[model samples]
Target: MILRRFFSSSFRLVSSSSSSSSSKLGGGCHRDGFRAVSSMPEPCQSSPLSDDESCDFDWDSLGFGLMPTDYMYIMKCSKDGKFERGQMSRYGNIELSPSAGVLNYGQGLFEGLKAYRKRDGGFRLFRPDQNALRMMTGAERMCMPSPSIEQFVDAVKQITIANRRWVPPLGKGSLYIRPLLIGTGPVLGLAPAPEYTFLIYASPVRNYFKEGSAPLNLYVENEFVRASRGGTGGVKTISNYAPVLKAITRAKSRGFSDVLYLDSVNKRDLEEVSSCNIFLVKGNVISTPATNGTILPGVTRKSIIEIARDRGYEVEERAINMEELFDAHEVFCTGTAVGVAPVGSITCMDRRIEYQTGADTTCQELYSTLVGIQTGTIEDKMGWTVEIS
Candidate 1:
């Protein structure tokens, strides 16, 4: 698994964004988190059936598969105004134009987060506000409507609560939430969509890294760049990922797990994983690539930063070249979906750099601390967790 920075920069957005003037939820939860959106489509009105009667699944032992539940949350906007309240409904297909902005020009943004089940039987959203705010930033970069933090958070809570049975038991897994904002308006003229849809769906996933806790081998292409200076490396647009599939496929056929991309401009600085944030633990100091607009700002990355600061370990976010990485004692990656992945070695053009995967490394410490908080095994000092039984 890797921590691909969430918000890579974009050459698309050239405008400035002002902060939303609201603070309803605690710690900027209700405000400054999402963009203002308009009202939603006609809500599907129906009472949730009992758990036994509603659709059921083997929540446990749920490998990474899409077990579609019975409901989803949806909100829409146009070129005129902000977003509106969305409604929950039976999960199904969505309407889109053949020439929609997303279909032709690829104007889209997405966020990935999960809701965990506590030991006491309540559900919790693990720092969803961060995910919400990140999605808004991505939307802004894509020239799309930004849903308010309240709308995003409420939609997730409502949709997940509507299908609480999908949330796995303690130590089982989580209800993975995927909130998407896309342009559905018919436009082939290369302009922003007059219509947009903000939709949320949940999937029960045991772990994103199918090969968990094991060492991974990464190939450094040093050829394909995930994002570059002044590029959309800082946004969560879908177009960024489509380009990496060929490289990853080529690596996998050779028995590699993922491809680590270098800075596009210099080919010396480290950017990030295809889906996670990369970190290096060299003896005592912790090193991650500086956010130069080409890497996603992962939620896990932020948590690691706060945790490292509290523990007083030397943490530096600066330029990390490919040369400096071979000298590191250990390396790991973090993201919302990928969790924390410890990299054992990096292969590049017949050369490889192997590192230790011992328990003594700070990367290990950070992983333990993060997993502890997410699984309710450790106290959350930063108030990053949100309960939703």
Candidate 2:
């Protein structure tokens, strides 16, 4: 009945409620006049699964990998056009030309967030509006049009509701939602694409690291860096991620969980990990690398900072050096995937320092409060979560 109610009248909620001028376009897909969306009727929904029933797949073994769901939300527009409307379709490959800007020039952006099945069997999303705003920022930097914040959040909710059955049972994991904005149209010149597409897909995922919730062993990379000043590093673009693969691969081969990149210019100050943000805790003070045109401002990192400040911890956002990092009493990593993970040890060159982990530590307390607020175990005093239903 929830699915039925969603599809029947509120399916057009984004289009009908939007006041942006982009909503003026006709509600249909037209890919540069080359193709049109399929006109077939949407598949009928089956009876809702009861709480006693389990998923078809093994829920206990869920990991941070792609496990395709039943549906995805897609919307398309020209480079100069606006994101008007989108629809949910079956999950499958999309058609693209060899000259597409995304393939040729790497014009794309992506955002990650998750939906947790609460203890009472309802679903909640953690600060998806922030993800939408971040995606809009990335779209502007990548030279592409973006969905309005309302549209982006609505599409995410639509896709989640469409694939609600795929959401892992409470505490097992969560449905990891990925929203992608890409240049889909052909381009022969070294410029922005003539068209773009906004797509959202999801998978049920558990811990990002193989070690589960255990503390991580990180390697400080002096040879490679993740981002720099006045670059796409500040924005979440496709081009910012691939260049760090070699460094991450090399670190993993050396038995480290991940690599901690430094400022490319100085190669001394802390930057971030391969896919997450880093935090250093010394005494009662918590410090993290500032987002000064070189660090990707993580949503989890922002939330954790506020939560820490609310809990009477002194939080600082500024440049942090490797020496200070090594001297810190505790360190932790935050991201949509990693959540809040304590860093057990950091190996810089030949010097290795292990931090305090496990119960009664600052990392443990923050992790508990963060996850508790997310999963509805604790009060959401900050009003950060959005209920899916």
Candidate 3:
């Protein structure tokens, strides 16, 4: 099989953390009895930042921006080797060779998840195993090595705990954890890198869109296609995001919240938004684009589907035509960043269609249920949450 190229020279990693706090955060525990992986690195024993409980940061003003945390997790392996151990490092800039695979070509995959501070003074992670599994799939497509599910979850726990003070208070926001797997080794020709690196960082964030909790207004772009058949569109590779920036930028310039893309070959079928999955509601039926080698199967999308089905809604995973938006009673988007966001309007060509955005709408209900389960207010009947610390 012909593997994808992985190399790049100059790239600085960006990550997020939680909010301000005075006391240090506690440890985490995996649902399957997995303990936090301790690093033997001496320097990592103490945080680069102060241990004071008061971080002098405002959690209420927290937006979806990068706020540096105290620590980060990192592991490395060779082309023909397996990842043995990873360690905690001070969160800062990382140097790479100009010919690194991730810099030169583009062999990298990333995953996004969040940690919520429980009401009872603890922390919970929402289906991190799903993110881990998704990262592995992306790694295979990007020709990169990935950490095991256990390792991935363990590292996430470690990173969150290390930056526990940054985690927002209950109902405030959340700690957004970002995991990156990239080819770090130097390479000149178009081939896989000699070495790989798995890194994890975090930031405290509130709403992803500047509109906050308000309904989103989307613009459909027929000229710009997100992904086609047999492409990396199905995976969460780093390269997949850059190409959509143009479309997203254009949409934002037009005062739209984001861009919704159509399939490359069929142009009439809806694929997804720039970074989330789209869904439509009519009566009691909910339909989303099928993830058939094109759409990125979002964790939030999967959870919402299961929740909607349990609530006695007929959920269909099929090709959604552009015309369906006009006939839909309600429309929404799902992703790790956006959550369950109601779509207020969809502008396609000269036609603009609007949908319901009330509290009783399907998207609102799903968002309430999803957030409740994630924050531990509602019972996790699906056993989807893992308590860390």
Candidate 4:
């Protein structure tokens, strides 16, 4: 299930390849000039799996899991602040030192986005620029160098194009893109790594939660805290996620879709869900938690805020108490994975509160609008969709 694409040689400081004479470091790998740094084969020049070959898998059975595609894009940066050229490679395993910074000190970051197949047979990315900016912020916080917004966006587009055959058919699913930045260099003490790896991989996926379009059941977790103020909560560092696994696993075991986390300081204000942002609808008003330091600024959450406001609904970004959420007309969660999911009920301290969820609900309307824009069925007046063929 874990497929990776790795070159032959490890991280080393080397001069640019002869074919990359016009290429420059710090931006991105030029499409025509890119070459592998080691004695590995020229991956960029290689073509992806043929359409017939890629059709071996059942697209309908695809879930939100890793089923590696044909190619992946990888690049590296050294301690001297110079980024080497990037290259595409066949999918497989990567070797890393036991004392790697990411292994010992958790010096890493990652991003997630998706590519939707348009009705016209082309592919389009949904606001990848936001993910690029978020990754840059995470990199700065994690004490690592990052790709520029331009480099990040370009790399995503290149990899999507290279693996275009793996993209699911229209209305089937989307190609989930994961861009990871890890400290590959060894580190004995507690400091940044001497080198870093920036890689992107794709997987065809459907819904995040098993409920799909059905309403979700959430348990309010008052025992465990997700993130604290002035902590790594504001940034999407790799270190911020794993600690919540036990709580999420427990919640799922109890038949709940996910757990709703409360603010660490007050333990009363609603923070966010395990992997999504929380939103509450009261009549014609829609409100979400203000991203102070604990909540992640999700790309889908941002889009929903704008979309709701444009639809003549008053949107508020402020602290939301548990009592307010229990009394809201409608409740939902938003993220890249879970587009927009309504909350059927919430169990807080053994007291259950339920809300109405149906096709005509606010969350469903928002989900439809967002999906329409992403799949190119609706007009993208905001210029959010970026077409890639």
Highest TM-score against the true fold, candidate:
2
> Model 2, 1-389: lDDT tens per residue?
12333333323212223323253221332356223243434333343423343357788888998887766777777434776467666666677889988999999999999998876767889999999999888887877777888888887887777677778887889999999988877889998877788888898899999899889999999987787778899888989989999998998999999999999988989999999999999999999999998899999999999999999999999999899966899999999999999999999877999999999988889999999999989999999998866
Better of 1 and 3 by TM-score: 3
lDDT (Cα atoms) of all candidates against the true structure:
0.73, 0.82, 0.80, 0.80
Count of clashing residue pairs in every prediction: 28, 0, 29, 1
Once superposed on the true structure, which residue ranges of model 2 sit more than 4 Å away at CA? Answer: 1-30, 33-54, 78-80
Q: Give the range where candidate 1 is weakest over 10 consecutive residues by summed lDDT.
A: 24-33
lDDT of 3 by residue, 1-389 (tens): 11112212221112222221110111120111112233323222233333344355677898999887766777666323566466666566677778878898998889999999997667899999999899888877777667778778877887776777788898889999999988877779898777777888888899999999898999999888999899989999899999999999988998999999999997999999998999999999999999998999999999999999999999999998899888999999999988888889999877999899988888889999999999999999999999975
Ranking by lDDT: 2, 3, 4, 1
Please give the RMSD to the true structure for each candidate, in Å: 9.5, 4.2, 10.3, 6.4
Q: Whole-model lDDT, candidate 2? A: 0.82
TM-score of each: 0.85, 0.90, 0.87, 0.87
Shift in Å, residue 385, candidate 1 = 0.9
Off by over 4 Å in 3: 1-54, 78-80
Cα lDDT of candidate 4 equals 0.80
Candidate 4's residue-wise lDDT over 318-353, tens digit each? 998898966798999999998988999999989888
lDDT of 3 at 200: 87
**Residue 388 lDDT (model 2):** 68
| Lowest summed lDDT window (length 10), candidate 4 | 14-23
Ranking under TM-score, best-scoring first? 2, 4, 3, 1
Weakest lDDT window of 10 consecutive positions for candidate 2 = 10-19
